[model samples]
Structure formats: structure tokens, C-alpha cells
Target: MTENDSSAPAPDRAPALPPVADRAAFEAELDALRVREKAHTREGDAIAAARRRLPMVEVDAGLELTGPDGPVTLLDAFEGRRQLIAYYFMWHEGHDAAGQCEGCTWVTNQVRELSFLHSRDITYAVFCQGPYEESRRYREFMGWDMRWYSALPSNNELLTGRQVGSMHIVCYVRDGDRVYETYWTTLRGVEVMDYNYALMDMTVYGRQELWEDSPSGWPQTMDAPPEHPMRTNGRPIPQWSRIEAGRSDDLTPGP
Candidate 1:
């Protein structure tokens, strides 16, 4: 076929297909990978089992937080539920909602429906590391109707040895007025908060993060912001949509 023919591959770009092989051979390779995939899934199950078996630590039940209705204790966050899942949202202190932690915003946006969590006798809440007035405004700006609280006053008591401004997913069990911290995780462990990343993981591009073991010629922009998956033009990707909708992101001072 001529170089310009439809069957001919583009000259400049790398071939957009996997290594050439017969159909049967390709199936065989995929089958081999399937074996490993199954094993990986089983391993994940084992890890989860171990996590469930982890010993819990008692937390300060009397720790005070600022909620919509004013001062409340950690136990109050449970809302009479058996369990509580608190997302420790990072904040820019003086920055507007648009300048809030992009990674936090992306994950927070994933939790639109709390009925599933509520059905399991669990309550999910955002414990922002900033003032209630500014942070609650950020929550409203993002259209998040879930329970929001300012953990800034109780950060030292709630987080203990952990860094105050970092993102964390902390699980707690409420027994009457007492609260116990069952599990806490950060960084990649918080990926469970993000359904978008889970969906992206199933795609051919696979998150496009530099750390993924993608095949050669795969579309991975390595130098892009790895921490902020939905970041664009120095703002969270969703912030642009909010701005387009005429929603004001100015919750605090400055950008």
C-alpha cells in the first residue's frame, strides 16, 4: 500500500496499537494477565480482612468542633449513627473556595449520595481544617449539602500526632457518648473516596499518572500535577465549571 494509504500508519506518531500478534496469541496473553489480575484481587481481599481486624484507639469524645448549629462534640458528628467517616479536608486558611485544596475538592465531590453510607448506619462528614464561616461557604459554593464542620479548634485533639493541614480519612465508632478511632489513612489510601479515579483506573489511559506502569506510547503527561487529578489552569477542574455556572468561589480573602 502507498505511504498515504488508509492502511498505512501515521509517520510521526508512535503506533497506537499493542505489539502485533494473531488473535489467538493475543487472547493467550490476556488470559495470562487475567491469572495475575485474579491473584491481585484476592490479595486485596486479604488486605481488607487484615484492616478489619486492626485494633481501634479511643478518641476524645469531648473534643469540640464548630458545626452549622454551633459548638458540638465529636460524638455529635455521629448523628446517632454507629459509625462515622470523616474526611479531613485541607484548607488554604485565607484563600477562596477556588483556592481550596484541589485534591480534597475532587474527592469531596464524589460523595453526592450519602444514603448508601447512612443505610450502613454510618455518617460521613467533612472536617475542614479552617474556620466554619469560610469553609462552610466553600462547601456551599461546591454545592455540597453533607454535614460540614470546622475541625480547626479541635485539630490538635482530634488528629493528635498527625499533621493538621493534610488530607485524611478517619473512621470512628460511636458507643453512646464515647468515640473510638477504628482506622485512619491518607495519600493513596484515600483513593477509596474517589470513584472517578476508580473509573479512570479501568480506562486505557489509566489515571495518566506518571507512577502507573503504562505500556510504551501510552498517553501519560508526566510533568502534569500528579496530586491534583482535576486541576487545570492553576485551579481545580470543577472550579471552572462552577465559575461558568456563575457561582462565586470567593469564600475567603485573596485568590
Candidate 2:
């Protein structure tokens, strides 16, 4: 093993055996698991149906945002498509601003294979919750090139049932050329970004969330600290403005 791997492969070599084995039991178990999972899903589906029927109040106000390409409209954000999902990334510039909302960054990191989401005609992007001029720099510094725009005025429309300033998920469906704010949920909705983590945390496979069924099982990683070199250059990077100005190399997450 090398420094990175820390473990060596077994030196013993054994004759390969035929791979064929009884799979009926395994198949049955997998089928049972699927059925059990579907039961859990049905509850969510029922709630979603009720949420969908909830009356939607229209807002005449429009918001302006800029993407990697340039200035774009809220409707243009749909990119002539149907359906859109936006993550409200809280970005208030500061060094390792936990104020950016750790959960928001966690969800951001968890997103994967969005091309499938696109194939489903779902246009997903991040609507940054801050001044574009301020958030843009941090976005670029973090190398996040997604469709980001400012939360002009305020993001009240997207965060109806959610607490003010809380991390959230706002989903929309575009009809024809117009966009309609469909289902939007905060707190719990962010779980969709966790991929398989939450699902696997049960019984023999417990969730990484704090209250694990098995105390014997190792605890899941709850807080993921910033990875940027703790100390930049010889100076501490205490502000996003400086880091965006090519001073990230000088960042030092407070000692």
C-alpha cells in the first residue's frame, strides 16, 4: 500500500472458482426491499399531491439575474424549456462563511448526473441569494459555473412556507413559454440532494444522520469543514472580497 491507500492487497492467490450461485433468495430480498421502499415513497407522493393542489398566488414582479453567458431574464432562465429547479445558495462574502449555510454547500456538492434531470426537461440552476456582483466573485472562486443569479429584492416568493434566511429548494415547471412556480419546499426538500445517504441509513444500513439505529456503527460525517488550504500564503484570508481578488491563496480558516 502507498501513503494514500494505507493498506496492502492480500499477497495470497487462490484458484478462481465458478461464479454461479443460487440467486433466488437474493432476488426475493431485493424485491421485498423495493416494495418496502415504494411504501415509504407513497406517503411522500400523497403529501406532494396535496401540495400541488394548494392554490398558487401569482406575483407580477420580475427578477433579473446573470448566468455564465451574460444577463438573462427570469423567464429566459427557463432557456425555452419546461420545468426548472433552483437552489437558493446563501452567499454573504466572508472567509469560510459558515453563514453561507453549510447545508446549502453540502447539497450543492451532492448534486450528480444532472444530464438525466435535463433529459427529463427539468432545467435546474442555482439562484444565488445575494448581490450578483458580490456572489459572482465567490461563485467563480469556488469554480461553480452553474446558472447563478442574484436574489434580487428578496426571495420571498420562493420561500413561502420556509423560514426567512433558511436554506431551501424551489422547483418550477415552465408551461409553453411562460414559467410557473410549482412545488417548492425548504428544509426537508434539501434531502433530495443527499443521494443515497439518507436512504441507506436504516437497520443494517443506518442513516448518517445523528440518531443511528446502531450505536456500534461508526458515526456519519456531519460537518464537512472547508477544504481550502487553512492558511493562504502567509496571511489569513478573512474576507471573500480579498479572495475573489486572487487572494484565496492567502486564505487561512481561523485558527
Candidate 3:
């Protein structure tokens, strides 16, 4: 049957499976695939090594940012660490939390731990592209306890010729009182912030996103009724959990 016809009527039921093979033949094919997997892992390591060696650019360390504790310098966000990784969280001015960027939420939600980064003399924080009061409420609503700062007033200085109000992952290095931009990535490059996508890659059906090239009869409804893989109830899939848990989606003006 075709992929569209293969989807089970119920979500709990299994869809379709790949062709069956003899035990020895299956093992032999898997062994060959394992070799390719190892090579892919090695190449990833090589790419990371190359990324580490890229030259950095100096940024104004005195750029202003607003946090829960009020105004702070960009250097201060580093929190006395040797390195800093800041996520440029996109925002919709005056909109409620539900209207915020889904792509940003999808990735940022995975960054729940920072102790490991601290162990490596690194600090991680979010440089939100809106008012601190509104965005921080969204952060609390989503149950994220990470350090967050509003970069709205200083986006020009921080982004420096790049597009502002867009999601970006920027790496920085501290040299005494000076700060330098080591690397910055956006779009698919920022997928590193996603654990769900990484885990989905290991599954048989994969992410089931429309763009993915899956085997015939694969159980993916990408772009059919759902359209995007990240949405379900007219909102990002993650927001549903918060909504179900009775979290407020309001970040509108005046509380």
C-alpha cells in the first residue's frame, strides 16, 4: 500500500514495516551500515575540530542588556566564565507567549541543563529580542529557569550587520575584560539545540517531516493535515504539554 494508505486509523497501532530478510542476511547488511555510521561519527568530530579553529571577531563588551535584575553589560552575561553561548530568542512584540516563535521554543526547551557547560568554564544564556518583562514571563510560563536577558535595545551592537529579531546561536570568548564572537549559527545549524530531532533520527520512521525522504509506505503525515511536523493543535507541539499542565500562555501587556 502507499504511504498515505499505510497510516493506522489509530495512533497506537503500528503502521507498516520494511521487507523481512533472513537472519544472516539482515545481520550482514546491518554490519555494513554500521561501518558507514562510524565514518559519519568520525566526520562529525572532524567538523567540530575545524569549527574550534575558526578565527573570532571582537564585539563591544559594553553593550546593554536587560535581565531580571535590571540593566547589565554583555560581559556580565558571561557570568565570570571563559566562554559564553547565547541564544538569540526571537519574539513578537506585544504578542502572547502562544504567539512566540515555535522554532525557538523547540530548540530552547532542550537546553535545560547548564552544569555541564559550567564544568567546562562556559556559560549559556538567552538574549531575547524583546522586553525583559514580557519574555521573562514567557520563560517562567514555559518552566525554563535559565539566565535570560533582553537584547532589544542593543541588537544592532550585538548582531553587527546581521539580521536582528531572528533566532541565532552565538558563541563568545572572554579575554580578561574583552569579549570576542567566536561563532554564530542559525537555521538548521542551530538544530544542535534539539534533542528530539536527534532522537527521532534514530527511529525507523524518522521525524516524519515533509522534507524527509522516507521509504515507500512509511507512516508520515507530514504536510497533509498537520502540515508541519512541529505543530498539532494550532500551536507548537511542546506548547500543548504546558497548556495541558495548566500553564498560562499570556504574556500580553499589564500582567
Candidate 4:
């Protein structure tokens, strides 16, 4: 109503619009996102590369393994299965089958059915690191019929590198008469096959990782620290090889 007020520009005029985002700014933001994403993808690729470099080990391919019927070879144990996944069960004798490996048996027990593996033309077996005579009874007691063979008298065949700990997944792809070690994983990769821990964590505890998705104060069994400046080695601490030859006195019955 006042003359001065009328002269002023309409108060309702929309505020000056924000400057249009620069292409560089937009692209830079996108680039940052991509960097995070690609880092993850590249990390996976790097892992696969390291596994590929694990080196191939050649065995006699002629050694005999006592199957249900009789002696067999490393190849015969495959039985024409296109793929083979073997778990190296650690045993050094004097431990008895009951104590072969509480950890290894824990995993084997979860294997629901080999029928699925059979259908896929893949053979799943376990290789014992001890003498056949010492391990066969242990296998029997565990009630596992999965194809098992002894890796005794280690020749060139690939060794289960379990110096610190032994749970591993070794994949083999057979081509004609040759067998190749394809892909192998030791850490969370093996956890993919783990059923119990995953289920229980969700129901109550939550994944025992540091950045858990649960509310504050949740119970966590594994308290591994973050990998920033403090690297988390994860489960299965490093172990000494069979060279130690545990003392017989170590086996004394608990008082």
C-alpha cells in the first residue's frame, strides 16, 4: 500500500535458483561412488588371482587308495565326476577317530546330501592326512561315507597347507586325463558352506563381525578387530605343520 513498498520487486518472486550442478561436480560424485564399488570388485578379482597362483601339485596319479572294494588311484577316486571338492581332514594318529578333528567333522556333519553333488557330476570327498590304518576307523565312527582317501607318504600331490589351521575348500576340474586345481578359498569363502553359525547369529546374536547390524550391546562370540591399521586375520589361527609330532604324553587322560 505504501509507495516505497509498491516500488520494491514482488516479495513472492522465487528465490534466485541454485546454480546448475557442474558436469565436473556431478561426475566427481559419481566417480567417488564408482571408486568404492570398483574397489570391492577389484578386491574379489585380486583374491581369485592369489588363489590361482597357489601352484599346481602333481602326484604319481598311480598310487593305490583302499576304496570300499579295494585299491584305487587318485583319478579312480574321482569316478568320472566332472568336479571334485575335497576337505582335508587333519589327523596325526594317537588322537583316535573320535578326536580326528572336532572342527573338520563339524563341517562334514552339515553336508546334507551328496545326491545333489552326484547330480551335478561333481564328487565330494575327504582326504585324511594320516595313515589309512589310523584314519579309517575314525571315518567309520563319524558315520561319514563320503569318498575318503589317505594322503599318506606325501608325493607331489597337492599338500593341504594347514600349518596354522586346516579348513579349506579345494576345487578340481577334470579335463580328459588331467586334473587341475581350479579355485580354492579358506576364510569367509568356507563360511559360505557354514550353515549353523549363520542361522544362529541371525536369530539371536547377529553375524559376529565388528560392524554388526544389531542394536547396541549384542553378544558376539568372535571379536576380531577392524582391518584399518589393525588387520583382522579372522578364524583358524596359524598352526604348526605335522613336523611337531605331538608327544605321546600330551595324550594323557584328563584327571
Ranking by lDDT: 3, 1, 2, 4
**Per-residue lDDT tens digits of candidate 1, residues 60-106?**
89898999889999999999999999999998977876678888888
Using TM-score as the measure, the top candidate is 3
Model 4 RMSD in Å is 18.6
Clashes of 4: 4
Error of 1 at 202 (Å): 1.9
lDDT of prediction 4: 0.58
Which lDDT value does model 3 have at 251? 87
Off by over 4 Å in 2: 1-35, 45-55, 66-71, 97-99, 157-161, 176-178, 199-205, 216-255
Question: How would you order the candidates by TM-score, starting with the best?
Answer: 3, 1, 2, 4
lDDT of 4 at 161: 47
Q: List the lowest-lDDT window of 10 residues for candidate 2.
A: 228-237
Model 4, residue 232: C-alpha shift (Å): 25
Q: What lDDT, from 0 to 1, does candidate 1 have?
A: 0.83
Lowest summed lDDT across 10 adjacent residues in model 1 is found at 1-10
Query: What would the TM-scores of all predictions be?
Result: 0.88, 0.63, 0.91, 0.56
Backbone clashes in model 2, listed as residue pairs = 83-174, 201-206, 201-207, 202-205, 202-206, 230-252, 232-250, 232-251
Sliding window of 10 residues with minimal summed lDDT for model 3: 1-10
RMSD of each: 6.4, 8.7, 4.4, 18.6
lDDT on C-alpha atoms for all candidate structures: 0.83, 0.59, 0.84, 0.58
Clashing pairs in 1: none
